[model samples]
Target: MNQTVRPERRVLAQRVTLAHGGGGKAMRDLIEDVFTSVFAPPGMEDQARLMDASLLEPGAELAFTTDSFVVSPMEFPGGDIGTISVCGTVNDLAVGGARPLWLSAAFIIEEGVEITTLRQIAASMQKSALEAGVRIVTGDTKVVGKGSGDGVFVTTAGIGVIPPGRRMLAESVRPGDIALVSGVLGDHGAAILAARGDMDLTSDIRSDCQPLNHLIEAVLTAVPDIRAARDATRGGLASALNEVAYAAGVGIEITEADLPLRQEVRGICEILGLDPLYLANEGTLVLFVPPDQAVSALAAMKSVPAGRGARVIGKAVTAHPGTVIMKTVLGGARIVDMLVGEQLPRIC
Candidate 1:
């Protein structure tokens, strides 16, 4: 990767640069001369002014968040970053009991990346957002010298409104509660892995990257007292349940026999030495509910198209609060902990 220098912009030389990603004069020129001219909306004349990563909206009761997508192959078995960008943010808001309304997308594109790919990605994103009933109200785009940027990087911020009287947060969890998952886990991570050409086992996995807002709505309607909820994305089911336990100061006792695992996913995990519990999933929801409503809640979740496989995976325990234990079918016990680090980075 050859470096480049251009003094006109008065910027230092770029290291390991491609013509598009160069930080030298070409980079500044690209921003000020090309991108700004073509894509910059009137309100966003200066990228610097966008530094705080915020917008002007008074008392929106916003559920604001940011997420970056770096999945190795931009396209995968179930979806590309386009759908991932939309679904991920939608789930984040849905988990918080917010109805996602608006989204802002920022792209860091490598120079020399095909325009065709970009178009397809945008279309996929648009379609996904429409299906989720959200709008892409604003966005930003930048091109780095080819090497500095991967094919592309996407960061999205979502704003959603929480429905009245439907507060969902970890603090609402309590002992004697139950943890329900919307579907079989590990599909998203395995789908991603399969797309990477890791033929550890025959490919039969699909990314669980569907939007969960409908399922969330159903659960809310069925059990307004739902304690807490989370989408199992980067850290898989084990990590998600642990967060609930930690946040609510409750113990989680999960039964291995009750945990849902598709046969294909189970086989792949066995071959890859991957623990399905720690793999990423895009389309699953983890909900905390009062033990009394657990059955109805599971029924409600299973009733949704996206939650057909919903089941009670575990229970909140009074003893050993803040800890998560797994009860094996053989009558043994094991501990489940937070993902100390990335079991698989760039999974989302």
Candidate 2:
């Protein structure tokens, strides 16, 4: 018996060039051979032609969000810029009770970056999209001079649908609602810091980069009256809690001991004089659930892989409305204000 060999599909260019951004054969070949090959977007058109049966349902609304990823290291432990682009955009919609359906990815490639890097990132994007049950329906690519841009920057726009009778907003959080985190905090920031190797730090920690749509769905199903939710991204959990507290006009009192933190992440923050609560997280989200439904919500979150560490970290309070306070283990309290300045820059 003889076996057939399939030729590896790849672009001829070893490194990206300005010519690849020109509207010519080089550009077409690059797009066709590298990106579209992996994404398999429906048609070769300027915009995606999209339709879904859910759109016809009465009271359903379309959700749209866009974000850009420019992490210092294009590839980091457990994730890359491409993976973050997809997960970040998907999560923006998921936290709002939207079912992600489609995404549009645009790449800004710096000349001299290896074509292999782009290929790897594109494949990662497609893999994440598949896992999130969404499609990358359209995209654009451009190359710049090496000094004009970073190795690569990715911008993603996501579209999702919110079914009828589902409305979640930060302002919906009541005084007695509980605040919960989907998983451990500060993993992404810690991972990126270690990967940069600038501070002579090392850790086995990997980025908690994952799409939270499924986890959010699970929680919503288990507790439909979730008041508010937000992903802990650039500004981390502290910022997210502050935003929710401000929007809902309630004070959020959290127990420092109850907040989940991995040992690696805590070590990194302590050594660097940083607060883990203010470090970024790509896969974690904070949500407010009614007190009566907190048990079910936590159980639902723990049921999903992305949310195994889910737990109640705090609760809404009427005192000090629009503030976040942390109860220290030493029988003391302090305000956990939003991050004052950039703690870790380019930490998607």
Candidate 3:
């Protein structure tokens, strides 16, 4: 038995069992697995062969990316696969210091997928891509026989342009640099947990999923000398910070109390035995600045819409090379280790 689940809460309770991936009625049911029933833009119905690849943009550099959607519960409190596919690509380019220009989406649809559901998802992708000031230039579609693929996995490739003199690279970070985050953390992972019906507490800690190119633009325009910027996504802040530390060969010391985690998000972490410091944030950013330029950079970031909550979370210290230390809320300190194992697997 496929154990029927509510159309709106499809992905939860109904785990992607072996049969769901099997070609046949079971596979179709999974593809049409309606979670929150996303409503996208107009006329964005169905992926069809309008086709042949003569598509080429006139001018601009490209930053390509591709990711698989295996997020346990696709329809979380704030976002879904359709939007994540777009926003995720947008942030990758944004944090890389590029102005997102366009996107190419590829879909791997399993047998038995519903036309209506696919249309809804397409609308979502179209809406997000448009809002981020990027166009969906081209893409591909493929069907997998029963049991050969998951319901519907999407891969998005993007292209963007980086203006001259606005260079950003991890190697640019040096001694006496400061670290800043755009906003609160842990919202995304917590929201996914809640949406999965994890009855730890009564709450709706929606995912903080937002494209950050505009925010990045505001900062770079004001302070083009930025060392590096990164969006703390999948592996969470811990993973992102660690990568920066190793790449820059510098130590990052952050204050635990300085972290901007929503109270409800903090509460959920407690109930679920999770740590906000290592959790994921979709809309946030990690920026490195020369010590003398921290104040002005903070001001530039705070002036932006997505960066209203921006603050100086910490600074690079010469003592702890290649490591991140977070002062404990209890007035003590502990090393924020890189994720050795999946903290909240499938939460992405």
Candidate 4:
């Protein structure tokens, strides 16, 4: 007798569809097969139950932050939307003097996106969260029509604990304080532009996208007296420093030559009519410390791998309060104002 043969069952959907977002069996299967399978920790409550919310520790003050990622191309040289989604929120908390703890992620996926791509993004998020010493305890996913959404958009919310007596704020900065940067700037913005292949320009620039909580922790540990810290994100170092100056009622004077910039990034900015100081950076931070302690702070920061390129770029001053001025390389001074509008849009 001949035996009947059956076709093998496929484990993944070839493409996302309306049914995948309808909260039905298909949706559940997609979540289970793609997201939950990778995000849930071993012996945890699973992804669905994890979405209910996390329990906080007793007598803990929490730092909460939320950010959305809408970078074009989804993937970049050094990182992707998934990695930035986690790192952005984590850095937000860290700069606020918080020890990052748990995170919640939400996904808006467009129909017709490949399941394999979604899985890759989730895996990247998992890797980033692990590196930052945080847990992805909760998340939600929704699907949109093909034309209604980009391939994928991720929003991440993070919670962290602010250690006792550690208060880092823009308002805390004062005149005579020193300004320091963690590393080379504008790599993220330049890398994204090159990745788009819009200008047909090519260079070896890569995005400086990485979690900065570890680096921040090291600095805080060594110099708890640091007045302020801010990560250079959307508007880059220029905007971040302007915010500090305005909040603290002080002026900031930076030397053009002291600012860290990669040669390739400088060339890219020159070719693209961009300023490296105003370009976005994913893994860079600007710190304000008392001039007396600037040496110790810079040393502490340089001890960490992430801060090896750290430099004392400028100083907070009383002259021209609420403004930022740069001493140009050629014995000239220029006003570095806050960016009037978006230099680059849909970037983080």
Which has the greatest lDDT? 2
Write down the lDDT of every candidate, Cα atoms only: 0.79, 0.93, 0.75, 0.88
Off by over 4 Å in 3: 1-62, 198-201
- The candidates, ranked best first by lDDT, are 2, 4, 1, 3
The Cα error of candidate 4 at residue 169, in Å, is 0.4
What's the CA error at residue 209 for candidate 4, in Å? Answer: 0.6
lDDT of 4 by residue, 1-348 (tens): 998763332336689998999978788788777877788743324342332122354445668899999998789899889989999999999999888888888999999999888888999999999999998887888999989998999999988887667789999999899999999999999989888878888778888888899998898878989899999999999999999999999999999999999999899888878988889999998999998899989998899888999999999999999999999999999999998898987778
Q: List residue ranges in candidate 1 displaced over 4 A.
A: 1-60
Residue lDDT tens for model 3, 161-189? 76544667887788788999989898898
Q: Total backbone clashes of model 1?
A: 7
Tell me how candidate 2 scores on lDDT: 0.93
Residue ranges of candidate 2 with Cα displaced over 4 Å = 1-10
lDDT of 3 at 251: 91
Better of 2 and 4 by lDDT: 2
**Span of ten consecutive residues with least summed lDDT in model 3:** 35-44
Q: Candidates sorted by TM-score, descending order?
A: 2, 4, 1, 3
Off by over 4 Å in 4: 1-11, 41-60
Please provide TM-scores, in order, for all candidate models, with all chains considered together: 0.84, 0.97, 0.81, 0.92
Q: Please give the clash total of every predicted structure, in order.
A: 7, 0, 5, 0
Model 1 agreement with the true structure over 62-137: per-residue lDDT tens digits: 5778788877789988899888998999889989988787778887887677655666677778778878987776
